[model samples]
Target: MADEKQPAVAPAPDAPREVTSKDGSSHEEITTPTRPPGWMYKGFKVFGHELWYASPLFQLLLVSLVCFMCPGMYNALSGLGGGGQVDHKAQDDASTALYSTFAVVAFFSGSIANKLGVRLTLSFGGLGYVIYIASFLSYNHNQNHGFVVFAGALLGVCAGLLWTAQGTIMMSYPTEDMKGRYISWFWIIFNLGAVIGSLIPLGQNINKVAGPVTDGTYVGFLVLTLIGAVLALCLCDVGKVQREDGSKVIMMKNPSWITEFKGLFETITSAPWVVLLFPMFFASNTFYTYQSNDMNGSQFNTRTRALNNTLYWLAQIFGAVIVGYALDFAGARRSVRAKGSFIALIILTFAIWGGGYAWQKDQVTREETAEEGFVTVDWSDGGKKYVGPMFLYMFYGFYDAAWQTCIYWYMGALSNSGRKAANLAGFYKGIQSAGAAVFWRLDGLKKPFDTMFGATWGLLGGALLIAAPVIWMKIQDTVPLEEDLKFSDETVADVAGAQGAADQAVTAQPEAVRTSKEGGGAKEVV
Candidate 1:
């Protein structure tokens, strides 16, 4: 007979008991795996098993699907340069408002997700997306900038909740070995939303030379987003989620508004090293304005822009896969993978941005002589010229995916607990949105293309430099459980105190050993 599968080991001493379902029908398992497995295992089935519902990969897919509909469609519209409207200014103005509120709300959204519950927060998050897409549909008919801008601001609030919860789940749900792979999977599914959403407009606007996207396009996007929103209600709470190995997700039980807010402050104070990544976060989305508007939108006509947009997001899937595999290369240590990814990011950044600078000079020449603002590169007409800019836009998409994957991977390195992951995700999105807000407003003011391009290049380089010290010196083979892992019922103060005590105890070990040797020549015994 084939060797029988071994039973899982008992849980570690400090690990929490598995949580039970609200209705008491099922109990979460707290067994330990002999070793971490890949995305699949022997006898793995896609459905009709308890493990399938509670699996981290499945949960990650659920969030990915939600994002694929909401932000994915949002990206499809945004990538169209002017939200598929002829007027770029209104899109710019609306983006400014959207990101401004997005920054503030996202910063606190982690706490909000914790206090209100991830399911409810996520369900509400999709509402803003629906409303925002509808505003675009209304703008197509009415030309009302005010309503569109208002919708932008409202969506910002909802996006904050959805993304914070999304981040928390992404970071905390996976085993250490699975973090990178999980991110890649989530990104692929999430961006597919953009890819598929782009297809709708690409198909509809294929023949029309130059005009706003049809009402049918917006309605289609709206329906998909609404479906995503309703699906959010189906997410399993963190308390009940179990990893493939049967370990429980670290959760904050019975969190109140007071504790939740206090926990946010503590995440900063306790893990101050995370601030080193703020510049990386800030630079993350800052280049979207230059890439989408100045380059793709200004350079291509309606149909070609849609084609380029589809390819841009398509590039993201490849980018995420590349970086994701690199980060999770099982042969290397986690720290080595992290440091290597950073260096690769730096090389890719310079290469892509440097190529962009050369392309921008050519774009500048065309802009000065063109009759209208748009430089009108029709894919059907221009052969050699079209290939260069389209490829450039696609590379821009790749660069974006690599940068974001690195950031999420770095943050995931810091902690595995759901509570801390939520705060870190919030901080990242908040800073990213703040930076985007500034750059989008600049685009609205009609900043020189060269200026935007130069800023993007400089900011990316500087952010990478600022993050070097932490990536090199601070990242470890593994985070200490005593330091990062916490009991569900512990308050912020209790968690901090435990960490402080752990530090003190660690620091005192050498001194005690020295004293013992000196007092009794008990070096061996001691």
Candidate 2:
């Protein structure tokens, strides 16, 4: 409220607004209709109107593209060094740093997104991924690990911003009826980074290239990332995201630093969030470190990395799409979808996966070089005939798909309104980063594979186990099924609920694109 007008109380619950913060701050956001004078999009046309360019669906696509590029390149690049298996501790060291930094950065991402607007926040975060990838061009194996850690830190900061932006925008663009479909599609498009990035390394790791990394191929990947970064910068600004009634979703409020700080504190301290810390926090890091360290090329040749990732991504794509439908099929109850999906993602349910890992553990042979890093066991004896792990890792796609979609989608239910929802999404990634940082500390102290399998089951899988019962029995969102409601409920009293309604209609536009207004003018609310 520092730089904005006083909040206006909504006459109805269906109104595009929140009446106040949980912290007892009395602020009523206003939703008002005010379109730019119609010339901004120029001649862009769909159905003969120059309005299609401004549609939230179009904006969502641009946002998705912004989310795609850098991480895709990083996924391809992160798998490159140490024979794609040997120097995994180094990989953990870098990743630990990435997530550790990400935790702190994520705490602030919502406020940053609020202040800078979504498009710019996304661009800023994407650039961080690009820079982290570029830093890899100078990797010199054992001699330059510190540089890798530094690069990881850079990636961590941007990732906090990027993921928060992604979650907020994705959640903001769909109406109650189509959210499941949209969330499912969003997961597929976003997770394509993993699938698509896998191909780059497959090409780069050809034995003909000799070393684990090929400089020329890596340079090409950098160029592709550069192009992607530029495109992300071209997305629509937040002030332009219009709702179904032509009232634009405004996010321009400049709340005091004290409010932002308190909001961050409140989010981390919430009961629902405390319950999520064990199973979900650090969950990605555990899964990823295992993937990067153990199963990647442990029992097979480096080329198999691409084959492995290809299958993993494909399965995940199917998993993501199916999970979307599953959630929708479960209907509007957040408790049902959240609990049901958690039970389904229980990695242990796929007992065959653990069996497969055990089968491969005996097969892969490793040996260390004369490098000081040789202090570690060398599994490099071409590791056993790596045939089983490729298939084994693919099973995680389903697990990952279920975990990612449900978690991000459920965040909307946990919060009372859009602004709080943004922060909750930030915590989803942030606290996890803190946990990842701690797990990654296992890097140099023990055989990476031992820690990888142990932590993967212990955390990623454990989180699901803990969440299943807790979400079912104990935890519930303060704003349950908030996204499922159509904004207006007949039971609520209203005096002037129709005041903000606009006559002009939007087709295929998002109902979630909330419009806000204050006494002086329309204030953008995240």
Task: Report, for every candidate in turn, its global Cα lDDT versus the true structure.
Answer: 0.83, 0.58
Top TM-score prediction, candidate number: 1
* Cα lDDT, model 1, residue 314: 100
**Candidate 1 Cα misplacement greater than 4 A, ranges:** 1-42, 45-51, 365-375, 486-526
Model 1 weakest 10-residue run by lDDT = 492-501
lDDT for 5 (candidate 2) = 28
TM-scores, in order shown? 0.85, 0.73
lDDT of 1 by residue, 359-421 (tens): 887665424624565457789765568888888899999999999998999999988788888
Model 1, position 42, has a per-residue lDDT of: 44
Tell me the tens digit of each residue's lDDT in model 2 across 1-526: 3523222322332345656656554444544433323323334543232344456556666666665566666665554433243446656677777888999999789877766766777777887776666555666334466777787898899889887877777765554334556677776766686677767677666453223555554576667667666887777665555444343442324455566666567655654445554457557555655565555544344565556666777677787798887866744465667667666766444574466457645643333222343222222333444434445667666666766776766654454333555676677778878877776676445554654576566555566656665567543533433232222121111211223332111112334223334333333233
Candidate 1's TM-score reads 0.85
